[model samples]
Target: MINVDNLSYSFPQKDLYNKVSFTLEEGQHAAFIGASGNGKSTLIDIIMDPERYMFDGKLEIDPNCKIGYVSQFSQLDKTKEITVFEYIAEEFIKLQNEIANICTQMETSSDIETLLEKYQEALDAFDAIDGDDFESNINKKLNLANLNKHKDRMISELSGGEFKLIQVIKEMLNNPDLMIMDEPDVFLDFENLNSLKNLINSHKKTMLVITHNRYLLNHCFNKIIHLENMEIQEFDGRYIDYNFSLLQTKIELQELAIADDEEIARNEIRIEKLRERATYNAEASNGRALKARVKIQERLEARRIKAPFVDIKQPNINLANNNEIEETIALKVEDFSVAFDEVLLENVNFEIKSTDKVALIGINGVGKTTLLREIFKNNNDCIKINNDIEVAYLSQMQDEILNESNTILQEFYDAGFETYREIRRYLSNYGFGEDRIEQKIESLSGGEKNILQLAKVSASKANMLLLDEPTSHLDTYSQIALEKAIQNYNGAILMISHDYHFIVNCMDYVLMIEDKTIRKVSMKKFRKMIYAKHFDKDYLEIEQKKKSVETQIALALMDTDFERAKILSQELEALIKSL
Candidate 1:
């Protein structure tokens, strides 16, 4: 439980956030969403420990509550003395001990202050480290963060995904009354993401999350607190509800302001006309009009209408080109294996063709990204790439591409643009406006960087596109914009994405990566795995005999075997199940 009033923070002259106020109730789930680096993390640091950061504000906090945080960056000291397992075990003991002490105090009926002093000592230590049920806690956390499968290994050897998984596990064991996590979903796989949702469901505590995972945000959080332009706004309900409500509020405010402006203008004109009339009739009429106008304007201005909400909608870059590869292969991988210190994929063979939109699905440590890099030779992998091919790759992390000295405009120019104005215009089409173009590349939000990367590649003449989770952390509008662009593209595409909507819309093929091997499947076949086979199949002739056989049965069951149809359906299902 906490409250903040008139909180403001500035960097020398620029105020990243100024005068933000909000409150969080005990056991409530809340989310903070805004453009990246718009003081979201800075605000979180302040909330977690105000004393640590220099700021002017009156923050009312439950002094008794111990705060636990899982940061997005997941800064860790790998060279620490203890082994990773030993460290985890010690943390678990500390948390369990703290919980035990709390119970001990309650049993002895100690005074709140004495209990507080003892509890705080244990809690501080526990919160600083990971807590009780070390094994289960780690597993649950790793599962949620999608990192637990890598636990037996040394911390130093783990990948970025592994580190992120540990951070989530640490939070689970600590069991703080309040949990603050930033970007917790970046590395989560399907199963772990579900585990996290279950944990959130079971936990009876306050949760303050900063994430861009739309499904989790919509499903888990009830309150949405969005920050932008150095301000914060509270809205009831989930992401979709918040978005709709915000849009409605904006439309209403715009209408009200327009009406008020017209009224004020009319009043001024009436007053001027009355001033020109020197006669008694003019003076009386004008005086009445002026008085009424002043009263109306004062009432309107006094009627408190909070500033209307506005959403940051990204621009749609419609990428289209002449259809080049209609019957040729786009990418082929045979006996593909890659690793730094360990092998990721082994003896993999797959070929992607024109008009075959594909998705490479895999878990966190499975090297979905590494394979992409290997395809472009960004890393080492045993594979053969076709010489006569054009390709563009979108990386999972853009931090490596960042240059501190470059501005957004300059980056575009460096990427091979003619002039400042040309790059500025191109960026504007991808959501960077005039005000944003002059901003340094380092100052741009994560979403902005992603869009910029997409634009840069979209402008290239490459007909083959290899994307690695391109839609990760992007907002709904931006995601839709990207989907539209890909749909409009005439070139071949072999993409890797987890966003269900985007994958379904843009993919005609799918490659499920499991056990370091790629099991390629036509998207049409994958759809059948989920469908119930209701009324009948499409009129087109079926290529696969298995599907055709089932279609005939569904058609035959229209009358004679309606009752026995369900039984026959089970048999058909059984046949497919064998696959």
Candidate 2:
């Protein structure tokens, strides 16, 4: 168990927390949630390394308990060459070394009995901690993450998402009493996210996860810890329940404040009347009455209710409608094949209708981002776009578009807005206040950078948007706001995201990239198919067979083999109808 009391942290510029307190009991799974830059990470840092930071707080943790941490950013040194298996088995390797050392001591020591006792003790400790089954357990988790094939691959060779999974697996292998994960869902795809959720649910340890993924928060955590407005608020249920309770509390506070204001006004009026009467009389008795009335008014003022809790204002994103264009297809890809030493995708074909909102999804290290970038390559014969359409692309790496040296105000102006009022109005829609406008871009958090890029994209007035991981670092509220904006957008959107909720809310179609092919399906049908695949093995096999046939058909069409394409088309039709 860990107890935190009166935790306060400050930087040279701002005070993040003030007298915040919370507790994490043994075996409790809790979620930490708040807007970006609200000190959620700072609180974790203080807990993990109290001496590194200067803060006033009382953190009481069980001395025997071990902590395992997975940071949002990669902590591994990419330059070092370490295989996935070696990394995950590091803890077990250390235990083995200790046991071997005990054996060596037994062979050399004069006090042979003492050495033998120590050796037995070490062996027992190893067995008690499941060290004997370490390899099997690591393999099982790696298989669950669909990374068994890459067990021998160097960590440096893996993609960011893959490496993140490895880090999570490594932490789990430690079997720590307390697991602290920060934004673990940022890099996970849908399948891996499910695996991670299942792991968290089954683990018999205390957990404190900081994430903006609503599904994970609602399903995996039994408690919610909200860090907002320099305070930490604890709730006893899931995220949805906590959110509802918070809204109700805000409403109640508002009503009480309104009543208090009215009563204070009435008291002040009565006090003024008494003062006027006393002045006219100018007598000792009247003076005494005025004093008494003044005291009563003071008491009433002292009893006035405090105002309601108001969240920081987030930006209001209002994307401009696309200009009218005659082209029905905003983008079309045919016979698209891409390779980087090995084939990532082949014979991929899809079309984005002018009014369509399409999502691109696939497993980690697949060709989702590759396919999106291929369109921008412009030299590829496979991709074609309407001549009059303007395209705006938000890459997964947000820094590609942001200028680190520029201030927020400067970046907004650079996006084509002329006046300060215009820029401020646009920034305010995204939750940026006057104080944040002058801040340098480099100092902004990841979520803030995402918002800035979104604001720029909205200002572009482009008819076609190619967004890669657009919702990655955004808070729940910001994500919902972006979804609403996308819903109202008249332009075409071809986005690559792992956020199932955002995809369902904003996208009309899904372009799933798998097995070096892209298959298009409606959002509703995709959801149903994934649900079926999860619960029924027979259904999953059928879907896999259908996908295989579809891929064959796409390949046949690309080769202009009309006869083969016709036969495969009939087979695909029959398969779908049967399902």
The numbered model that scores best in lDDT is 2
Off by over 4 Å in 2: 10-15, 62-65, 75-82, 94-130, 143-162, 301-303, 310-312, 321-324, 403-425, 534-579
lDDT of 1 by residue, 1-579 (tens): 889898888864257767889999887889889765466777887887788878887788988887778766564575655544555566666567676978777787848787777777877676554443456656655555444556667776654555665655556566677888887776566555655666666656788888877557756887788987788888767665674444434545655665677766776676666556634565576777767766766776677354443444557676654336556776677777766667778888988775567888766667787787778763434454455557777776766454536887777777788987887777778877776676776655566677777887777767778887787656555776788788877776777775545676788778888787889777676556323331113211221333334444434333333435445455545544443
lDDT of 1 at 434: 74
Query: Each candidate's TM vs. the true structure?
Result: 0.74, 0.81
Work out how many backbone clashes candidate 2 has: 6
Model 2 C-alpha lDDT per residue in residues 146-193, reported as the tens digit of each score: 789999987766766777878888887778889999888886786777
Candidate 1 segments whose C-alpha is farther than 4 A from its true place: 8-18, 35-39, 48-57, 62-66, 75-84, 90-150, 156-162, 228-230, 235-285, 304-307, 310-312, 318-327, 339-342, 378-388, 525-579
- Whole-model lDDT per candidate: 0.67, 0.79
lDDT score of residue 567 within candidate 1:
51
lDDT of 1 at 323: 39
* The best candidate in terms of TM-score: 2
Error of 2 at 427 (Å): 2.3
